[model samples]
Target: MRTAALLGAILLIILGLAQGDSDALGDDQPMFDVRKVEIAGELKYSDPNALQQYYDQLLGSGLFDDSMGNLTNFVTRPPWIESAKVRRVWPHTIRVSVVEHRPLAYWNAGQIITAEGQIITPRRLPDLPLTKLMGPRDTESVVLDQFSLISQMLSTSSLRVAKLELEDRGAWNIQFSNGIRVALGRTDILDRLGRFVAVYKSDLSGRIERISSVDARYPHGVAVKWKLQE
Candidate 1:
């Protein structure tokens, strides 16, 4: 009876070990599991659904091999997406965190184009209110570069530029907050602009009620137009 009882106990231990091994193998398999997803930083313009769709496509491609390097590359490729992190939670939901892009201005296709000469679409409009910059379609970079110089000049003079447009012939037309247009010719921009500033400071600082426009293209001085009474 003792011998039979000992044999029974040994058999039970072997069976238990086999069951444990099977459970471990099951745990080793990759299961669709995500617990928590966190997103941060400038998400006002980003669509959550679009980001999720991108994530789904990547995961479906089987590119993420549960490795850190592959996962890092997957998240940072897009220009708009700043960063992304994915985590597995429990059963079948992947938690994804993402950072979005910020736009500087609304590039109007009719007036201004992007650096790539692609017509700036309304969909790419930025939330931030920036100065409108207009130029020929293929000359956006040149116009943008000039605008930066004009902006600096205005800053020094404590003036604000509402709109800056580049003419087809390469001249510049700028508007100020006070509803005045400044015609700056293609050449000698800085010198002509300096003359206008000197006139504003010495002659027309506060005496003029309104200024319709200022023509700064002439060699000797600037011609000012007074606003008509309403």
Candidate 2:
């Protein structure tokens, strides 16, 4: 009879171990399961449905062994999300905050440049009429800086820079909103720009539609090219 009792006690201990294993494997322990997920952010480009789905996964087999680090990393994986903050409430709740990248302009042909000069490739492009900026890889900061300065300089004029390109040879060129292109060459970019602005405001503003291109490499004067008569 003592032997039978010992076997029964051993079986009970084995059952207890099995139950602990089931809990560790994320089997719903009701009280420990995540019941709510709260997200906060000014979302513009990131997918809201995907965010909800990701969080819903937690409701099924959750926070039992999940760390806050994993949750934070998941929210920040989207290219548009610049940063994220995550918090876990005891028992069954998680709060997440995300910061999205503010797009400044279209970069290259398939990426976007943020106001902070970060280049990110997103799943879709924005429909906004943002000017396009182009340069070789690793030159995003240089191109963005020049665009800012040039835009600021032209703020007083009706001519807005619609496109800006920096050649691999260090030459720069700009296309104005009126479809006129200007070559700033390899040196004295700001000086050449200033000259072009002066000429544009004084001489070309009235006849801008007839202009094709302006070569601003000359030291004293700029050479204007007119479009062929149609």
On the 0 to 100 scale, the lDDT of residue 52 in model 2 is: 70
Count of backbone collisions in candidate 1 = 3
Question: Model 1, 165: alpha-carbon shift in Å?
Answer: 1.5
- C-alpha positional error of residue 5 in candidate 1 after TM-score superposition, expressed in Å: 32
Compared with the true structure, what per-residue lDDT tens digits does model 2 show for residues 1-230? 99999999989986776576674544436435577788798888878877677666667445556676777777677788899898777656877788899999999988999878888998888887889999998998989999999988888888888899999999999998799899999888889999999998888989978998999999998999998999
The candidate that achieves the highest TM-score relative to the unseen native structure: 2
Give the residue spans of candidate 1 off by over 4 A.
Answer: 1-40, 53-99, 110-124, 207-209
Worst 10 residues of 2 by lDDT: 23-32
- The lDDT per prediction is 0.63, 0.84
- RMSD of each candidate? 9.0, 7.6
Where model 2 places Cα greater than 4 Å from the true spot, the runs are: 1-31, 54-61
